[model samples]
Target chain A: MIMIILFVFLCHAVTFCQIEFVKVPMQKKRPIHLALYQIKLPLPGVVSILHRASGLLLFLTLPLLLLMLENSLHSAQTYASLVALFKHPLARLSMLGLLWALLLHLCAGLRYLAIDMHLLNNLKQARESSKAVLMASFLLMLLIGVRLW
Target chain B: MVSRVVVGAHYGLRDWLIQRVTAGVMALGCLSLAIYLALHPGLDYQGWRALFSGDAVRTFALLFMLCLYYHAWIGVRDIAMDYIKPVWLRLLIHVFVILTLIVYAIWSVQILWGY
Candidate 1:
């Protein structure tokens, strides 16, 4: 990008430079030395990606959740069976996972909506909102985790 | 040869609009639902069944389900497109997603008005 800018700059200033400026030779190379842990992704960016991941998690678990709801409302017997299933450690763990996904998605989604509506315009506001989103998700997760237990 | 007329991001405009519209509705729907559930404390099986037995709640559930499925379809479709490179595999997964959402929609209808 800098090289392209310099080329354009030199083209404008130099008399001998060809002015046919049709194609800009661009470097197709990307960041090959990208170390995931070393790079500090801004809070908003982190939240954005986590939103996508949490959404996928929710999507994958939707069928099972729908089944659970169906069975719970099926009959007294089925509801009782669901309650019994809820007692299993694995069931509880999966439920917790789903809850976290829901919380994260919901919070991040609201943040996005706020941004789209221009509720948070500046970088500082974006950072603050993202922080609030994460904090709210964590607080809700903790509250619900305790309640579920 | 098919002549391509449509150009640029406008091609995705419909999907983008559907995504936003469904997202807004679902967000509001979820908030209202949470409020309703909070008001009804210690809801038992009978309470739940009677609640959905009413037409208003059933319609609300069905409408939200539609919006949710639409929203989810776009989201999942985008994800699969991004991560799943193989064209055949991507198509298979996309078909499975569509079929599953359809089945879930039917199941939701059954649950809401099953009695």
Candidate 2:
């Protein structure tokens, strides 16, 4: 009976030591192996990230846009000057970019709202909606760009 | 099985709701502006001024501005919480952002109602 107890205790001790050793290396190796750049995100992930980017862009530009609106509405002279500024090629290009960003953001926001409503709760539907958003926004941007040019 | 209860500042639902509501408001504002712009093409000074001259439009614009600020605050705060881990640094950033947003809010009011 004493010999059997000793053997069982030894087995338990060995297994516990193995577990501790394995856990230590895993904890140590995790941060080094984690690489964000190496990961390939899916479509919905890309759309979600772009939504954040566009939101940030819009948030940052709010001041500039408000200032422009204020200046344009301030007086006839300022308004004319603003119009002339916008007529420049660089300004038009930037305006186009902003317009596209706004449209894309709006589309993505609607998709998110749908998801929040539990409309597209499944992965497949979510992916399809994200793709639809991308295509629709691109098409709208192209149409608007043609009109602008 | 053992279960653990987690305790923290629980404002997630409130923030989520606020963001959605403010987004809806902003969307409405954008739609109105788009319609106005489309109706009045080649918008010059007087035309632009006329568009905002109405009491309804001005009120909507002011509401839009307020919604924009709140929407931005929630979004930016979430971003900061995600990327900035240090407690003190995150707090400092939060302060700075709050101050800037307050300034913008005041500025927006001045612009909209300064006539």
Candidate 3:
């Protein structure tokens, strides 16, 4: 087992070293590394990416959310017990995180809605919508955070 | 060609109708939820139960759940179209989501019905 482990480690290290070794092309070629720092992604791009990310998070975290809701609704005693459980710091933080995720997701959904309504079809409108999403998400997080606190 | 056009028209109309209907459903549900939250103000275990157990509340809550699932499904479908590459994998993912949503809707109904 030790010998096999050592062999695997050596092979991995060799591959890692090769990856780190950047090949400098003599000619411009296809100019693959075009102006490395010149490109700037817009707010809409960032918001679009975060919308998908938050959606994934919500999807993966859904089972826990459903469990909590079910537990809280089972009976008066179970509901009280669940509420008490949420008094812990970890639970509070988790709930706050969930709220944050939800706020972002809702903001993104609103952006989609605006697009669907043809309210933000142009470049300028799209940019403004993206800014609105960010601002709205921040404001929501603040309100919810205060409430949670 | 005529058959293809007829089937295409059917799907297009169906999807368009569903999108509009679900959008309206979610809007109403969300508006009611907002009003409920604003009016109630505080949260207590018994109060929460009483609040949800009423017939009007139960019906609205069921609509809310349905709208939520519908909206979520449409959103996920868009994401799958944007990201999922292989047609077979996309179909599998869509089937899984449909099954899960059906189960969740049934479970929610059962709970809401006091069963």
DockQ of all candidate complexes: 0.64, 0.61, 0.17
Error of 3 at A26 (Å): 24
Candidate 1 per-residue lDDT, tens place, A1-149, comes to 99999988887776443332322332334337678899898999999889999988888888888888788888999998998999999999888878888888988987877777889989899999999999999898888788558
Q: What is the lDDT of residue B68 in candidate 1?
A: 85
Fraction of native contacts under 8 Å reproduced by each candidate: 0.58, 0.67, 0.17
Query: Is candidate 1 or 3 superior in TM-score?
Result: 1
TM-score of each: 0.81, 0.81, 0.73
Range of the 10 consecutive residues with the lowest summed lDDT in candidate 2 chain B = B2-11
Report clash pairs, candidate 2: none
DockQ, structure candidate 1 = 0.64
Evaluating just chain A, the predictions reach TM-scores of 0.76, 0.73, 0.71
lDDT of 3 by residue, A1-149 (tens): 99999999999998887665544343434456567489777899999888878877776676677667677677877787887998899998878887777778777776787787887769988888899898898798888678657
Q: Which scores greater on DockQ, model 2 or model 3? A: 2
Ranked by DockQ from best down, the candidates are: 1, 2, 3
**Candidates sorted on TM-score, descending:** 2, 1, 3
Off by more than 4 A, model 1: A1-25, A28-32, B1-10
Tell me the lDDT of model 2 at B58. 80
- Model 3, C-alpha of A100: deviation from truth (Å): 2.2
Give Cα distance to truth, residue A104, candidate 1, Å: 1.3
